[model samples]
Target: MIYNFEDLKEIVKSKVSIKRFNHIMAVVDMSIKLAKIYNADIEKCKIAALLHDICKEMNKEEMKKICKNNFSEDLTDEDLENDEILHPFVGAYWVEKNLKIEDIEILNAIKNHTLGNKNMTLVEKIVYIADAVEITRNYPGVEEIRNLVFKDLNEGILFEAGKKEKYLESIGKKSHKNSYAMQKSIREEIKKKN
Candidate 1:
């Protein structure tokens, strides 16, 4: 039950691997910056970023128990089968149940950070994009996406989604349905702009 900022850091440090901790720190820094740029609630953004991957390293059996205990429409049985893709949902529920956080926006940001949603809020977008473009992330085109985010958030979102889809397809893996839905929504929004 990490209630405060310090407690959050301490818990994350103790639980996650060193590499994951560094990535979490990077997300915290980047989420704060993006929160300011996008006029989001910085507190919520920080909370979301800090706990976004709370279950990332958990074994599938452990994560499955958490989901079964707290499962809802937001986290269905089907979602539990794919812990790799549905970790965000577990993280979100864990935050709410364990940390006693009742902020829907923060919970939603955590829940949808990985796959995204149809109409994402600024905070949600910030968390999702921050997790990808944080300084520690060094995949190809990350710098380009980082720069794009500062200039045009929606374009950055589209680029990230497109990149993710392409990578998944290249590996013969189908992206979560939510990702495809969000991509469609982003494309539609981009179409409206052009």
Candidate 2:
């Protein structure tokens, strides 16, 4: 209800494609609902969801170039290699630097949404997984995951993340699609279950 649509428009103009802005807005609305359900920080979730795909439309080549040129050495090799997934990190950087936003929590939510790190904050996990399972999204097995989110978010996030990790790995057995953070998060998630 309190979304800054004009700010969103300005932000989208620079970082996201026109088509993606609507998707991001949809995620924003869904995330707000999730925040209410999960007791997460609503403002953080909204900002994170709105800006999640800010760099989604960047051509893979351009994405790679931006990441290569600007990212700190802190990024893992897997992050460097996966341009498709690296867009979130790039979007966070641009948002921080250009938009002058200093909220690390919001930035971290956007930064790690793709390959979730271990011990993510509530807002972080909610935004990360919610973007994947928003009401409007339709992919194979998505409905089950959506139901899982309402029942148990941690289980849902881990389940989907694990599934995605496996799919990415199956894409290349030797050079698996799993990132160190993703693997770490799954183990952390299992530990929580135990």
Candidate 3:
């Protein structure tokens, strides 16, 4: 079944809490802004941003069940155990299986939004950074990271990845392998630019 943007918005609203819905909206707005600036596909950004966290509110068992049922081969043991990282995988599957979204870019953006991979497309990067630095995110240094994203997308990603790594380490959580890969890839991209 084909779904329009508004259809997607309403569906997401009903699935997640009001607070999560608001965050999704903020990410959508931020994604559009970044997409315009970066020459990425705006529609893809909006769709990806809206669906990135679709499974975030789901219980761990539900998310794990989806993961086990659909793409168990693709997930690591660590991913199954980590709720923060697991939702993206389940979300990607949910959108593909339930919503009939065939676009690999959108699926990948949703899958990678939580722990970005080694090679992120423009839409992927835009959605990832937008989710992190959206308007409602009021963590320390967020404004600076937001500004840096507008200045240089790769730099913004690098900084955000660093901050995420540090935070994960502080909490005694091991950073996902994809996160490390993303940082390495972004650093190389930045080097190529300079």
Best by lDDT: 3
Give all TM-scores, in the order shown: 0.89, 0.82, 0.94
- Candidate 2 — worst ten consecutive residues by lDDT sum? 173-182
Deviation (Å) of 126 in candidate 2: 1.1
TM-score, structure 2 vs. true: 0.82
Ranking by lDDT: 3, 1, 2
What is the Cα-based lDDT of residue 65 in candidate 2?
73
- Model 1 per-residue lDDT tens digits across residues 1-194: 23588888887787789999889989999999998888888988998899899878878888888777765655657777888766887788777888788888889899889999877788888999999999988999999999999988888988998898899899987777788777788778889989
Better of 2 and 3 by TM-score: 3
Q: Which stretches of candidate 3 lie over 4 Å from their true place?
A: 1-3, 72-74
**Best candidate, TM-score-wise?**
3
Q: Where is model 2 more than 4 Å wrong at Cα?
A: 1-5, 13-15, 59-62, 69-81, 173-183, 186-194
lDDT of 3 by residue, 1-194 (tens): 24499999999998999999999999999999999999999999999999999989999998988888876766787678878878999999899999989899999999999889988999999999999999999998899899999999999989988888888889998777888889998888878878
Query: lDDT tens string, model 2, 39-142?
Result: 98898898888888888777777777777787645455656777766788788887788767778888889887876766788888888888888777888889
Candidate 1 similarity to native, TM-score: 0.89
| lDDT comparing candidate 2 with the true structure | 0.76
Q: How many clashes does the backbone of model 1 have?
A: 0
